[model samples]
Target: MTARIRSVNVGASRDGVGSRGRASAIDKQPVASVEVRDPGPKRGGLGSGVVGDDVVSRRHHGGSSQAVYAVAREELDHWGGVLERVLPDGQFGENLTTQGLDVDGAVVGERWRVGSALLEVTGPRIPCATFGAWMGERGWVRRFTERGRTGAYLAVVEPGTVSTGDVVEVLERPAHGIVVPRVFRALCGDLEAADEVLGARVLDAQHHAELERSVARRTP
Candidate 1:
């Protein structure tokens, strides 16, 4: 089957699993349809690109660079086997649960036409404490990082609606070959991977700053 959205998900913030009750929408629920648009900046601007998708933690996630998150259904199934639990659609807070796409291998700067929206590849979805807490697994963050499947964040290039089964077609891709896996490895302290991913000119300014600090802090 061709790459397509198996489900579109969105969620509102829920209490607990964080300090100061830092609400999270990581437990997203599948939706029949939703609108996608550029959410502009993080703080003052709208947090989520998908209408009604809450991004409560503006200090960290959401914004133009991370307007949407996609994870492959194949990857979720793999994790299900690893964790010995049935992973459901939107289990990882992904806005789109995709089928037949090598999401982590998508190069930075790649453009995809999904539904009526045009989306651009941005960066890897980094793991955080809240995510680990939600999973209820020991060393969940480290485990997720070590597994090297960070998924992919995307920015909406054109405002449009998306729904389940929308085909995800690659409209364009840069020659740099800096895919999401390499970028995620860089974020996880792989020095050589850092150099390779940073070589891609398409790395956005916001992501560039985060990558630099993460690489430096993780490097021994």
Candidate 2:
């Protein structure tokens, strides 16, 4: 199967897990069409998170580097097998559930032309506590991190509407070998590997800073 969008999901306001009473937009549903644009900075910003998508936590999500998150259907299937359940599209709270795409293998600076918009791969989606809560699984964060198939987070280079069935065309790939999985591995425990991502010229500035900090902490 060719690499194409199987679903476009947008989040809505909903109650979160645990006793925090926090609102979460993790329960995204498939949408027919939605606008894609840059969500600016991480804190106190608005960007492309779908027309009706709710970004409850701006501090760590929904920024230019994370304007969109995508996961391969194949990866979802793998997780389903491990979890012993039929994983549905958007179950990971991904904006795009892609088929026949190696999202984890995509180079950090790679550009994908989906529909009328252009998006650049920035990094991997590091599994967080909220993600674990949503999955309602034990040790999900560690399991997901060790799996190293964290999918890809993308930045919008050109605003446009995208929907299911849109062909994902790779417009460019960085010369550096810093792919999404490598970055995920680096963030998980191998900080030295982050040097590879630091070499990508087209990497998002925000991600660059975070990786730089991680690298600095180990430098002594």
Candidate 3:
């Protein structure tokens, strides 16, 4: 089974996840579906936000999949029709919402079909201060680390347009079980956790080195 996209909503901040100022369920018809929008001279649109449709990543700006998880069609519809209560303070800012898929189990390089658009699990999006700023708390980043429920980033594998109310199904799984959440936990200030992450082999050389450095700093 796989989770399907119930709808797509984009805003500076989420008073709700849909157009009705409320979270739209998977069934209630998506208000605004998300797709990779290409920008010309102007940099800032649907796909890449500020840096345009390119691989430009800074602190909190770039093409990163917000939330990827498994849910039921009814849950999708319920959220679409009403407010979604996920965060500690209760707000919504999901790039793509779906139903029934083990997202944490997903691995890098694995591709999935979410409507016409094909999304590949590129890597994990590192949490930064911007997320904490959005939450109105300096230590809100700790919530993710403490909870160990960080989401993964998706890169468009095939050029196809995606819309609201599209079904999301997993097409592949990684050979290893080193999921995103595990990576997040391993990246914490703890050296042991960082070493665990180093053993995962999911991270690239740069990321691996970064983790190694972080771990070494804590070493005696």
Clashing pairs counted in every model:
0, 1, 18
Q: Which consecutive 10 residues in model 3 have the weakest lDDT in total?
A: 50-59
Worst 10 residues of 1 by lDDT: 16-25
Better candidate number, 1 or 3, judged by lDDT: 1
Which portions of model 3 show Cα errors greater than 4 Å? Answer: 12-31, 37-57, 63-92, 137-139
What's the lDDT for candidate 2?
A: 0.84
lDDT by residue (1-220, candidate 3, tens digit) is 5466655534332334333343222121134545453221112423342111222222233433322222233433443343333431113234554546555566655778876677766455554544445444446566545755545566555546666657676788777666666676677676555676687666656568878888878788
| Cα RMSD for candidates in order | 1.9, 1.7, 7.6
Q: Which residue pairs in candidate 1 have backbone atoms (N, alpha carbon, C) closer than 3 angstroms, thus clashing? A: none
Arranged by TM-score with the best first, the candidates are: 1, 2, 3
C-alpha TM-score for every candidate: 0.93, 0.93, 0.63
Candidate 1 regions exceeding 4 Å error are 19-21, 213-220
**Candidate 2 on 1-220: residue-level lDDT in tens?**
7899999999886885522657788887898878988878878778444567778777778888889999999999999999999989999989999999999889987999999999999888877778888898899988998888998999899999888999999999977767888888777658557665576544566666777887888888
Whole-structure CA lDDT of model 1: 0.89
